[model samples]
Target: MPCDACATAAGDPTGAEFLTTKSRLLRLLAPLLAAALVAACSTRAPLPAAPPAATPAPAPAPTGPLTGQPAPNKSRWVPVAWSELPGFDADALHEAWNAWLRSCERPAPAFVPLCGDVRRLSIASGEEQRAWMVERLQPYRVESLEGTSDGLLTGYFEPFLEAARQPGNGFDVPLYRPPADLTTRRPWYTRQQIDTLPEARAQLAGRAIAWVRDPVAALVLHIQGSGRLAVREADGSTRLVRVAFAGTNDQPYKSVGRWLLDQGLVRDATWPGISAWTQANPQRVQEMLWANPRYVFFREEPLDALDAAFGPRGAQGVPLTPGRSIAVDRLSIPYGTPVWLASSGPTAQLSRLVLAQDTGSAIVGAVRADYFTGWGEQAGDVAGRLKQNLRLWALWPK
Candidate 1:
């Protein structure tokens, strides 16, 4: 006999009709089969019963916030009340509005709808903006899968260096653009190889965009990945341009600071410490620089009055807002996400909003971040010394 529930579930509507037909046929054959039924049952064996239906497995529980959204590939987002976010109410939202507005220029898919509200609130008061955030966003305490919340926070900045259009007059350290055959060469050339090898030199022969006087400063530019250059053109007039990261030689970034530490040459590996050592041992500067095999190429960009206000474009493809832009691991927290950062260390105490507008090779893990401190010497000073503990909260759409 057909199972009515199973038949209906399978979308076959003839189960009930088949049952009625079987009843009529049974009534018609009842008298004729009465005597033979007992004999037939005694002679024949019973048919095997149908196998039981398999049960479906249950779905896995959500690993993200209550909203049921999945966490980023490298981190989990545990939903928390806004009140739990330390100093959320105390932070001046207007200061971070510029970074939020910049994020709108290339908003992520999840944040696309919120950009309009973000723009409107740009002119609003801090208290009003805070209130708006409370209503529109959900705060998630960022953590690793192992439930670790504390992470390292470092800083980076744009350097300002003087350069020459041509290599002469003591401006001999060349910064190059990506070579024409850059793609053809896998892990093209190490920093030491590029400096000493003729074949490597030939590949980058005419690719120098500008040349600076100090090799140390050029190394700084390479590590920072970008900088502002006051370039002296062939006409002797100076023009300010930005050198942005183009490509690398595909070598690993072995830290010169780590090299110094491992060699027991210095206890401090900050830029200031490195500079002091380089000045003392000028002859060994090349040896110190070659400690790191990686090399970065750059492309020159025009720095107009409007562009001067912002830092060089970050990994997110947007101009970074100093003090308000942070580089995070894209696998942990995506670009363009607004974050509430809180840290208290020897260098500085920070409790404010920042946008995840950039990324760095070293800025990995669930809660790690590199804070952008803007440009020039002072900014560089802050960036060099900023290594501290950090905690982060991601403010996502409700």
Candidate 2:
């Protein structure tokens, strides 16, 4: 719901005006990023308590037939020829190169030696870039243990919300930092427990980072793991800051979207549909939120025009590249690995090279992935709508 500027320019990194107004306008139009937030939030629901951790299988080497080290989970990898990669020639390699460079910020051991070559290729043409990949990297098609080549691919993004320094004028819901005892506890309070239990509330009393108008907005921030806050300062001026994932309460995540679907409360479990339900059932907002037991804590950081164009750092410890970064199950595909992705849905017919830079709780399957759709409404729209069939080829150092 951000102004046309926020919606139109979020995907374009060069939009100086977009970056300037992004934080301020984003809070006003929560719709801009709401969809991605929903996707990410819903996906973060804890997996049914995982059984005891199994001994990880050794990972395969950079070569060989579909045989080698096993991925941590049930994911499998099969070596594939570059010719098998769909639309390999059509993608903008430079765009993916940006993500690759970001990944180099904390390059994997195999990738560390190739950093110089990667830097030189920055100025190379698309064809040249492709040649570099073909010459230096091996492509391995990822699969599920069931031998299926396909799996689910969803999307998520960094959200921006409006807030007040103090709780008043409808801004009553609090965004809190982690409690002093968060790390010491096995599992902390549930969402419902935190809302109604006096002890839980007291522990978080002085930890409020900011206050928002809607409890749902606070919930969105919790699920997405990070977001930007447009804060109304005491002097009546607006200041922008980013809240990052500091820790979680160690409670299992539950999918509220699935909960609503199971309860037959909503026909479509998308953010818009969920929002409508929340509005119509204001009395039951707490019930809807309590459906998920997990809670996230945050730490705030500064946000400026330069930083506004990028997203929060991913598991790879690098700023995410919009349109060219993805969150993969780290155990299946190591972080910093480059990947060839082919997924077509209502939002886009994507055949692109992306970096495995992040991870999500829901992105568990070997072939599963969560696309980082950038920030703002436009990114959210694509991410929210993008639950598509996926094929992946990991591009590793030869």
Candidate 3:
């Protein structure tokens, strides 16, 4: 009996009406009602449970210049065991080449295969490469592939023909791999022998450097990107900039890691001694080795061979034969392509054709190379100890 007029005095009434009615009913019921109150008022439906935080992406595994799941058949392709030319005969290769050419109207796989090697046509001089360039361009087209196009077959080669000059290492050299082999069917350098190094010994801790630019794949781009390190200066500044490669205990390379190490100038460790160190520092190996260039392989013959677990280059069988790995210009040379190589000088040092089984990020152009470190710690140690001279040639039927 407080009245219907009191319902208007009760407030805005939607929710309040519920309260008022309950209060009135409770009053009428006297002390029988239990206590109650609006727990969560002003209302809308409770929010849907927030989706569980999305699972974090897994951290990528540690690797050097390789990414995703790897090539899948990465280990399946072994260096061409050309002792007796292995499985495919020269005739069989010819048939395959001819068949592909007939069907595709382009250079066959012999010209390129997954990680294969092709004979690099030797241009005696920049003049020669230029002459070929003219024929392709017709003087009217001042076309330059540099910084544009794949560059592997054209632009990348010009720099070598003009600058590096294969058989010409500074003064005169007979120690280039293909040159030595072409002249003698053996590499110019070998584990048992190193050719008459026309190039002088690495002065003090000096190393050499080369460039692989605007590569085709992001995998390579990421490596070159990461491989790059800023050279800091004293007083928190840096002056010079360079892309370095590992030098050979036998040759010269200048990767940032190598440059740092060379500046440190390690002299005591022979191949065997380095192996012991990698074993002890197994935990932070790449970090330890990256900080020290003495353990990064750029070129030169590895003391042992390649182990897939490590890098590339090594000896594999019981008969005591050489195992090898290399990187080549995928544009000029295809993967799985077999190459016959030769070098110069008096010794059968680096003279033999091996399968171009492996590839690397910075490894570009027809003349480029990366020797694999063999299996296990020894291979890793030996691979870390390379850097050398080079020459390249592709194998083909005369």
What are the per-model C-alpha RMSD values against the true structure? 30.7, 10.0, 33.2
| Deviating ranges (above 4 Å) for candidate 3 | 1-256, 259-324, 343-348
Per-candidate total of colliding backbone pairs = 0, 6, 57
- Model with the higher lDDT, candidate 1 or 3: 1
Q: What C-alpha lDDT do the candidate models reach, one value each?
A: 0.72, 0.71, 0.25
Ranking of predictions according to lDDT: 1, 2, 3
Give a tens-digit lDDT track for model 3, residues 1-398.
00110111111011110011123333432222111011111011111222221333223223232221232221111211122221212121221221122212223333333112212213134334323322221111001223221112100000000112121223121111122122342222321123223342322113322222111111111121112112222353422222222322222122322332454533334323333444554564334323312112232321111111122121110111112234454554444433433222221123333444434434544454443322222222223333333444333211
How do the predictions measure up, each by TM-score?
A: 0.82, 0.82, 0.26
- Checking candidate 2 for backbone clashes, the offending pairs are 1-31, 1-32, 32-377, 46-253, 59-69, 60-69
TM-score of decoy 2: 0.82
Residue 32 error for model 1, in Å?
99
- Local error of candidate 2 at 219, Å? 1.2
Clashing residue pairs in candidate 1 (N, C-alpha, C atoms within 3 angstroms)? none
